[model samples]
Target: MTPTPVDIPTLLEISPQGGIEGRSRRYEKFLGDMDGVYRDEHAWQDAVGERGTDDLVYWVDDHRYQEGPGALIVGTSTLLPGRYGEEFAVTRGHLHAVADRAELYYCLSGRGVMLLETLDGQTSAIELTPGQAVDVPGHWIHRSVNVGDEPFVTLFCYAADAGQDYGVIAEAGGMKNLVIADGDGWALAPNPDHTGYRAD
Candidate 1:
């Protein structure tokens, strides 16, 4: 099949912190008929160390469904303890730029804010919880944080396919994301699954 073009901007979403101390309202949904499976905390944690010791541990779909010409499906575990038990994780934040693929984030559990920044001095923040799905549009620099007691788990659906999307990340700078190995372990700050994708 040919790759479909996506209006990535339409997918970027950000939730603001609310409820006095920003206590998030929980959201839920049943994936009874979804093609993906959910793995628990133990399995998620074990896989992290095996892959690269990720502090932002989460489960993933690997691949759920194809939306645009390219695609990505990710599932988070829960947020890690931050100040006063707020969940959070900080990656190379400024790295891994995509070429027109929309990045989608879903709050499976916990409450938190999605923080985004760019190398050019632009910044954006969003708060989200269960039952909400936010889209991180293409060509923007971004990252996320979990701010609730439960670990922050969300699904990431990529706009571009693995070969062209993750590849560039694997070949750049000093940091990278965690990916599955031959038997479900993670690689140590390994290169991205694919390369050469850039904003157009």
Candidate 2:
């Protein structure tokens, strides 16, 4: 006798701060330990003090798919307004382990920038705002940086098998450039911490 398969439903609702109400995994980055992640170590200590730990920098809510293989993995991230040194608050950034898996990101609210880089050293930046959607191609390492006064919210989706390779970015000393506030606007400047970065 064969067993019957029951259909299960999953619903998710996002709040203003990019929180998805449901079963999810949250990941956070703090300012205290981000000195090595940003370009300016001096500015980081000045902005958040040397031992600041209570400040919430950014977080991601990963809604893992439980339907088995080939299911879509969805997630949302909220980058709070602040600075890591002279750089804005940002995701640690990562590349897909498969190197051929793609991802899509939709901006829910606030403003930010999406940074993309290839393993061969190619780099680009996309300005993000409310209602904007960006497709991240395969083999590209990506990160999100918040440049607004308010929280930056983004919803993203990708394949379940698209595992992340975060250590590559960390070993490379983060992205080639950093998004920073310039007066009332934002600017992209070279990251001092980025080693072996080539403009070409």
Candidate 3:
């Protein structure tokens, strides 16, 4: 049998402050893009009024050489510190489009939380500081929450074919819990608006 051809290996310069020197793509999310992301509609609207829709909230830089199932996508997520009422800043969050795809997230700088949940109501929230990481298994819907005063930066890798189903969270009225301020620290509060997730 013939050996399969392999793709050329590439060197990546990853920044703890959030970037990939050889990144092939960059995606940014602004305050205006987070219309229904936050549970506090009133506070979100107030923030939009004060900060304007152009305010940068978070951005991602990723590198991918191939789109095949066996390929991998590596990236950095930078979430700027922010608050909408008592809630901290967060990624829009998603489950993999393929459902069974997994992901890994390693903290590069600042502090944050990896909020994970299943369709049947199981949930987990892991706090991460510089050098910490989370291995998110398949079937989990995940989101990143910035709980520090500075930007939360994380290095992430996942299957190239995972894609993303961001609408799952929106359709469920946000995740099951919210990462919010707790004195000078952070804590999780039940998201009153969550209506549970649906696989469909």
Candidate 4:
């Protein structure tokens, strides 16, 4: 049987937070009893308010396409600028269920940091700015923090089969480090709640 040629779109229009016209599903993270997921309990309380669920900390607009044996999942994460005590607004990162699936993150707008960590506790934080992109290695848990005044946005892409395992990060108490806003820049602080984290 002869296969028919398919035309791929050359251009995709992006919205402010990185949503592509008709190909986006928005997901949000709010402040609640995230104590089990964050290093700073005081900050979490302050940011989420005493009652919790007071704020929308961040959101992701996912645009995905499944093509035959593989799939392309693209997402734009927007972390709102605020403090969870000393920590900045961040995504509740996840690990790929496929274990060996790699991903790529491209800074679309705003400024922030990408926190990557392995299950064994090896961790690193990379600066995210306009025009910057980072490759996320396999078996790593990843999250993003917004340290700027405006919403920090990034476009990320990974394999469709690279299912997310957010429970791993929650069980580990978030990333090994937290991104906090300095006077005019940002600073990295150890996640006090992460017991397995070691200084590098």
TM-score top scorer? 3
lDDT of 4 by residue, 57-150 (tens): 7777776554433768777777887776667777778888887899999988888888888877778889988899999999888988877888
How do the residues 1-200 of candidate 2 rate in per-residue lDDT, one tens digit apiece?
65333224568787757878874588877766465666676776676665475567888887775545677778898988876556777877888887898999999999989988887877889988998989999988899988888999999999988898877777778777778878887888876677753221
Residue lDDT tens for model 1, 1-200: 65444323223222322111221123222222111111123443444435444333332223333444544443332334232111134222333344444567777666656664333334456777788877876655555554455556665556435223323332333123221222322122232332333443
lDDT of each: 0.40, 0.79, 0.93, 0.74
Backbone clash numbers for all candidates listed: 26, 0, 0, 2
Error of 1 at 173 (Å): 11
Kindly report which residue stretches of model 4 are placed more than 4 angstroms away from their true locations once superposed: 1-11, 33-35, 50-54, 197-200
Residue pairs clashing, model 3: none
TM-score, per-candidate, Cα-based: 0.45, 0.86, 0.95, 0.83
Q: RMSD of model 1, in Å?
A: 13.4
Local accuracy of candidate 3 as per-residue lDDT tens digits, 82-138: 999999999999999988999999999999999999998999999999989999999
Q: Could you arrange the candidates by lDDT from highest to lowest?
A: 3, 2, 4, 1
Residue 190, model 1, lDDT: 36
Q: What C-alpha lDDT, on a 0 to 100 scale, does residue 60 get in candidate 1?
A: 26
Select the stronger candidate by TM-score from 1 and 3.
Answer: 3
lDDT for model 2 comes to 0.79
